[model samples]
Target: MTTTNDTRGVASQELFERCTQIRQLLAAGNANFHAIGVQYNLIVDTRLAEKAGFKNAPEFLTQQIKELSRSTLVTYGAVARAFSAEVCSQYGVSLLNQLIVYVEAAGVELDANDPSTMLISVPGADGELEEKFFGECTVVDLRKAIQRLRRPTSSAPLPAEVDARAQQCSAALTGYFPQQTGVRVEVRNRKGKAVMSLKDVPLEQMEQIAALLSTALRSSRAA
Candidate 1:
């Protein structure tokens, strides 16, 4: 696959404008879920061009874009579509917000003009570190918070309140696995990379939590 770096002129402008517009739409809750899907298909056109040796050809880019699935296309047609419509839908809004707030509150702002970014560490079910994002947040502090929240207590099952909050933390990981359709309650290792335990819980609970995650990721990206 040949990737073109010449995203100058109209292509760049189109991407930027589309991204800005999508942000405005989503912030106002005016986003058409189906349309987002359509955009996704169009955005994937670049890949098609690369494979077809047409990466530098705008004609091929436009032509390939016309062939994507209408439903999923909108979700990736532009920068905003890819992040907002697709990534956010998969991740969740509230989770993203917490990330943004967590980072901002920690005073880890990024230089818009620079490529360098910040990193934050969140804990997984097995008390292992999961690198969350590069933002304006303190990685050490976030890791500390996740560690404090996930550690099993001796007296009880980590307390009812603690369990609930910890579950919220787990829900943030829905972005990592698309096959996770059901709710999972027990702590597990990230993608089962290590010897982590898995527990299956009520399906309804998982769906609800996943919804929150999707919303969070979307909103956080926008913020």
Candidate 2:
């Protein structure tokens, strides 16, 4: 009877032969490494799908790869094709995955023509939006700049009555829209007049607010 060792040896030899053939094909320029890498990633992604009852890995990986900076993706793809996964692991390719979040949080748009520059929007001291150019920035530098930009600038306290009115407005809005998560309402005294501001209010909520105001106005007129 044939032993298990013989079968194992045969399988190993067959795998080695297939790898040699593939190497020769790639060397002769008859195979495309880019296409090969994509196919390989797809196969691995499929195998990784729904593993341990989690289906998010494949989709998340695809989206993360898609969202990488164009320059980073180009560099990574070249390195990946030349040395495959080993070079990617060595070069910390995961850093590219965080590029999107950094750019978005910085509230800046990347210049596709020049990755070293960004278009940033900042609010002026007078409450006007200002567009500015941030040049000569790498990904890490841009992230640091964004962190500084996001820091709170105002330390002044609100007037007591304005603060109280703001809190009352917030509480009333919350009570009115218990299911809404992002709604904000603020009421402040500005030059002896009440100024109200609403932010992140949903469209449906805005419509409801309008209807309620119209009803209140009609009832006041009837009185």
Candidate 3:
């Protein structure tokens, strides 16, 4: 029974190793193919379909590579050859997948100071551009970090009255919390209800703001 268990374990380990090897090879091949597609400009040119005896490029690819999805082809082809190669080699295919989504959404810029760092610009709640940095890190970790940074936390198209109130609140608080620069209050109307939000206030600053509010309330009560 012991020998049988050992043999099974060895077989499982071998299979796992083989799968890993195949995955890596597939990643490398995908990167190479994408680089070629970009260089040849075949990804976007639908006219090439007629020459290739197909109705369209999508049709040609679908028939030729039935297993591959059209979205994957387009995404891979969209990446710049240089960036694709670097991402695939250094970060592996998993990171390349997430990087493609970022590239498509808002675009990515290489950090001037550090070649290994990628800089993504996202819109802050205060209507300012905020930079999110991804240094040398695993794909899973970087993806999670980037997703958190990019997630939209605020509601949009507030009612005119709510918007005006939010603006007034922001202006009033700016005077009290001059040290907390670049913070804005947003008022959103949802289902006839008003929701107030303070954008980008750290915990310590929030405590300070709370104290100020408490003091003001006490003073009003005394008056």
lDDT per model, in order?
0.44, 0.47, 0.53
- TM-scores of all candidate predictions against the true structure: 0.20, 0.28, 0.42
lDDT of 3 by residue, 12-85 (tens): 45433433443444466654544544522443452444443446555555554554466655555554443546
Per-residue lDDT of 208 in model 3: 76
Error of 1 at 208 (Å): 49
lDDT of 2 by residue, 1-223 (tens): 7666665566445433433443453465522434434433443344433332324433433443443343543443443434444333433333332334456676646333333244554454565645555443344544554555666443555666555555555555656765547676665555545567877877766877766546544554454
Q: Which regions of candidate 3 deviate over 4 angstroms?
A: 1-31, 50-53, 80-87, 103-115, 119-135, 155-160, 163-223
Off by over 4 Å in 1: 1-7, 47-223
Q: What is residue 188's positional error in candidate 3, in angstroms?
A: 6.4
| Per-residue accuracy of model 1 over 70-149 as CA lDDT, tens digit each | 32233233323323444445433333334444445556663322212445666667868666554443445454654454
Q: What is the lDDT of residue 160 in candidate 2?
A: 61
lDDT winner between candidates 1 and 3:
3
RMSD list, candidates in order: 19.7, 14.1, 17.4
